[model samples]
Target: MYCSANGFPALVVLKMNGLEYLEDWTVEEGAMANLKHLKIRRCGNLKMIPEGFRHVTTLQELVLRLQPSEFFERVQENGLDWFKIKHARSIVTKR
Candidate 1:
């Protein structure tokens, strides 16, 4: 998805839901630049976090709730998907 420069300047927190059919997502460079917290819920089919998150320097926290256990495993330290969000100060996963 593309986040325009004028989008949500005050949006520090974001929540996404009902993304069962979403297998992948790609973010444009500088997208969600000011987003500090992100909560993703019920995204069972989302295979991995977007690679573009590495550019979101302002992101401090990530929360994954009600996702598949396997999905949670991939985001753990040393896991395959960990690099995408390792910069975050906090990462929480719930299955």
Candidate 2:
């Protein structure tokens, strides 16, 4: 899909069984600046996110399932500050 006309970005919830072909996501980090919400599920092989994913000021929520690491938690803890983001709402991990 494409970004909004205003270019304000979008909220995405990713739910993939595996991340074998997710290299494109890392490669296109710059272009996905408008992404707001990201949810990754069962991506156990995923080691890291795009470099600038932490700087996505428009990012609102980050959700992860089957991820048990400090890195992912750190991203959720430090990155995507809701207060700093005007439209950023909230992050919800797997329950």
Candidate 3:
């Protein structure tokens, strides 16, 4: 949660398996501004990505390795496509 709200320039790698240690994605959205490669694993509690992520045009690769049954329980849940990223590396399902 220490990531700056303005923009995290030097932060590239983000691995959140035991995401229980931190808050939800909304609280960590600011840090994602300048991120390149992101790895989101085992965050079953997470519903969706943050809002400001649309501004993060620098992102390249993304790995979504976990999601519980209720991931889309509610309607109007904005999907990951809004990120508008370029050069997607890969999107693999662990199961």
Question: Would you list the rank order by lDDT, best first?
Answer: 1, 3, 2
Q: Write the per-residue lDDT of candidate 1 for residues 46-77, one digit (tens) a residue.
A: 88788777777789999999998888888999
Name model 1 segments beyond 4 Å from true: 1-10
Superposed by TM-score, candidate 3 places the C-alpha of residue 79 at a distance from the truth, in angstroms, of 4.0
Query: lDDT for every model?
Result: 0.83, 0.51, 0.55
TM-score of 2: 0.52
lDDT of 2 by residue, 1-95 (tens): 22323333343444456665443234233445667676777666555555445456566776667664643554464553322333446665652
Q: Which one wins on TM-score? A: 1
Candidate 3 accuracy as TM-score: 0.63
Higher-TM-score candidate of 2 and 3: 3
Candidate 2 lDDT score relative to the true structure: 0.51
Q: List the lowest-lDDT window of 10 residues for candidate 1.
A: 1-10
Q: Write one digit per residue (lDDT tens) for candidate 3, span 1-95.
A: 44447656677777778585543555244555567777777776676555555566666776666555454322113445433332344444442
Q: Can you tell me which runs of candidate 3 are displaced by over 4 Å? A: 1-4, 21-23, 27-31, 69-95
- Give me the overall lDDT of model 1: 0.83
